[model samples]
Target: GDSDRLKVGELVASLSYPFGRESSLSFGIISRRGRSRSVSAGFDFIQTNAGASAGSSGGPLVNIKGETVGMVTMASQNGTMGFAIPISVIKNLLPRLERGEKIVWGWLGVRVSELTLEAADKLGLSPAKGVFVNSVVAGQPAEKGNILPHDVIVAVNGVEIDNPREFTRMISGAEAGSEVRLTIFRQGGLLQRSVILAPRPQESGGGREG
Candidate 1:
């Protein structure tokens, strides 16, 4: 995803009650984007100084006209700043909640790491960006799709990916039984493959953490 989805200068609004009386409006911007550095394995979060509070929990944080973006959940005790899960990710999760369905992830059974310049060059890649497939499970999607070790994935479903986080993010967004197109650079050439994503088999021994 790109910053275009978020309009920084636009007034980001939220409902709050400083004294827990009645709902009051507060505003901020897309202060920052990306995950909280402290959460080792969480989706990207939006950082804002909007007056979120405990009483305001579950209230929609939105744009000026109140286009739902996120729920007011946390704030700093010292009134320094606050955090929010981005609307892009929220839009993906709320539907499941409404359906009373649990969130599940499709596992590829691969342990990948971001490729460094030297490592990418060793693999004959023209550019040194994206995640490198370190290993793949014998019978998982990575293996089934012939995602070879050392392959540098540059995109998923036509979306350009430059890191392991983005790679996993794109895959997680895809629905089970649907197909995803992958762009990979291997040896000295580029390759494209379509993988029919399957729900991570619960019985499978190998898996990715959800």
Candidate 2:
């Protein structure tokens, strides 16, 4: 199945060996689409109500026609919700893995969160948009480029962004060592910064890149 064509409310099934038992199938609908949570890296996830357990990671999430649409990756602690990595993500990674090439994710070295209406008002932004920089890692590209905490990143390379996930995806898509322009709003002023991205470290500290 074309995962891109998947829609919310579509019925799907997750196949996995929960608790080391024999292969099991759980049914549910796609609860949400294109969710990028803090815990997962790279691609956004397909949120589902399907039952997934500890042993369900890496199992196939199929549609009504038995076509693999996603791969079960994680679940909520109470087992009420599940998240699946879209098959499109696997499709992109498979070629690299097969060729024995290392998957290099670009890093900006800054933690960011969604900009709230209150924060936007405080920042004097007419529209409540852009991601708010929570912190900048010392000696990293963002810090080196003078990105400070509380700064609001309005755009990347002139492309306006509205959320941390969008910003993260844009940064990760760029090649390492490439310089990208950031449009920022700070202290009721606008500015731009050119920062050279670095390779993402093996262990990330928090959400929204870096």
Candidate 3:
């Protein structure tokens, strides 16, 4: 059994066998909880400075309550940081993993770019934020929900969206067929639409947030 739920800034303990020192342990705060800005596209990472060294890969990252939150995946080249794949990602793929099936993320089918200051001002957005829709896949959830190319997505299920990556992170994390309310800015007007996310199929052309 393992834990999948955790929060940002939560205290965590890393159980490792650094340099074969069995029963070794290290402590650190969760420095970041969202998608890693450094990596292009992958699962969200739990960033920390927990001194994970050789022989630490696959070790459990437990919370202060001794609940596993993530598993150490890799270390930075500079040795100043460590990256862990959130247990939720693993939990979602476990069944497929057991069945020897390929894993895929949820798809929203909208190509988007970060909202630029120029576009924001022209679009009457007081602050430049969120992301601009570039295109929508044919017959996908976005097109069905009237998510157009010019629309700027401001929030998802009432959670404020800041950038393209964050938008992708939120949507991918959502369960397929789950209803999501999207708050959008279009032609100087605010609109809301509920969309049902779909599972991204292997080799399919699912749009990306840029």
Candidate 4:
């Protein structure tokens, strides 16, 4: 499990203490920075290629500067890839645990799809990059923010989104209650708007309210 430490670019190191002697070492950049798979009580994880092994459980996954980032929870079967819970996830839950706060994953209420080259061209996206809005939940932040169906989203918080996944990734990474700026290409022109972020609601829950 990650210490849930969400350091944007924190440097750290990983130390493995196996029952036997000798420690292994590997390094790579943090890939896919964002929130955890779940909202309520989870931390975003760091995707890495660090060599982690059995008996390395509860070990320290650090950054380049030796800061603790996470632990070795699981690894790829072929031993080619690895992942760790972000340190921030641990930090957030730690405080809440001490305070006895119960949390649940939430949703922001929007449906989106990847902008394929065809879709992008149809939407008038020059280089065929951006997220396409499929639908907006009624009364949700997206709807309230005036993000309508068929809008092509190209950027969030000044970060360009080349795919629908990137759009969700950017939004999920934002702090709740923060106003997120968006660059949307609608019908025929480029428009900018800000949407306040909220907890993401579960998809299974239906009938979106604006």
Candidate 5:
């Protein structure tokens, strides 16, 4: 019964006010969920194939039972696909929005990629499935914590990391000034370090989390 959670292939519909056309119904289904597109601070969106026209956003996307599941955010450049911010995210930020507070994003300030088998072999890792640190932004949490480039992160707070999304998920939930423990693989050795997170800078951009 949770509106925040949805399954792939689930039936979904929208009531849009596209170009001032209110109450216009479009039929479609959830193509995917928990999709994050890079933007300011970034938010996970529900991917749908629901047809929408100009101004379709600011409208409600509903489930079969007429529950408002999401709100249209943008259409693809070619209008072939649509993205909607999950209502759960809005609800989570509503309190701050209501209080007229600026939204803050958790910042780790590190760019990462998936560990490839070749890289694993180069790094002497077997069966590599961990996240690889590509770069670290200076003056940010990762850099401040001495998370150098080429350090392969294997875990966070004792939880094994399998991909970049898991890494972002862990950091996104963290508050500024909160300390996080990271397990890193550097030069054929495993090391652990504690990092204190900071709020994302005003001009920062979010990375895609699929």
Candidate 6:
């Protein structure tokens, strides 16, 4: 089944062994599509109203035609909301996993936040776009590349971006040690910076932002 074809309000079911019990099915509709990567533990997920519990993670989320569209990942404490990693994401990683390759997340070493309309106005921009750099980790790629705080990242490799989550996805998807061109806005002027991404560290410490 095409996960990309899934839409809000579409009926779906999840098969899981909650509480270590036998596999059971929970029915629900797609409450939301395309959960942000930042909020979904670095993977894009779809929000469902499906009831899931402990031990439900890694179960299949099936559509009406009995096609697996996603994998159950997590549920809210109250069990009212659930999230599933879309099949698209799984498909992309399957080949690499099968080849025994370790997943490497690209690191940028910068903390960023949303740039609101008010902030955009003060910056003399009409439309609010891009992410505002909050801090740069010392000795990291961003700092090494001369990316400073107060700079606005508007594009990556010439592709316009307006959301921090999107930026995270783009950077994390890129291979480590690859050079990327960043278009930044600073002091009402636009400039470009080339930064070579580093591999994400296992233990979170000095730099962790993707």
Top-lDDT structure, candidate number: 2
Q: Write the per-residue lDDT of candidate 6 for residues 33-125, one digit (tens) a residue.
A: 754333113345577977466677888999999998889877866878887877877787788889998777678888888899988889876
Compared with the true structure, model 4 gives a TM-score of: 0.61
lDDT minimum window of 10 residues, candidate 1:
34-43
Q: Each candidate: how many clashes?
A: 0, 0, 0, 29, 0, 0
Cα RMSD (Å) per model?
Answer: 7.6, 4.6, 6.4, 6.8, 5.3, 4.9
Q: Name the runs in model 3 displaced over 4 angstroms.
A: 1-8, 13-28, 32-59, 64-66, 72-105, 204-207
User: What's the C-alpha lDDT at position 83 in model 4?
Assistant: 59
Error of 4 at 71 (Å): 5.7
- What TM-score would every model get versus the actual structure? 0.62, 0.73, 0.66, 0.61, 0.65, 0.70
Q: Which candidate is the best by TM-score?
A: 2
In candidate 4, position 164 carries an lDDT of: 56
Error of 4 at 122 (Å): 1.6
Candidate 4 residues 100-207, lDDT tens each? 875544344578887788877776778876777888878888888899998887876566876654455456544566667789998878899977767665544332
lDDT for each of the candidates?
A: 0.64, 0.80, 0.73, 0.62, 0.73, 0.78
Ranking by TM-score: 2, 6, 3, 5, 1, 4
Which has the better lDDT: candidate 4, or candidate 5?
5
The Cα error of candidate 1 at residue 120, in Å, is 1.6
Native-vs-model 4 lDDT? 0.62
CA deviation > 4 Å runs, candidate 5: 14-28, 31-59, 72-84, 154-183, 188-194, 206-210
Given candidate 2, what's the lDDT at residue 44? 57
Candidate 5 collision pairs: none
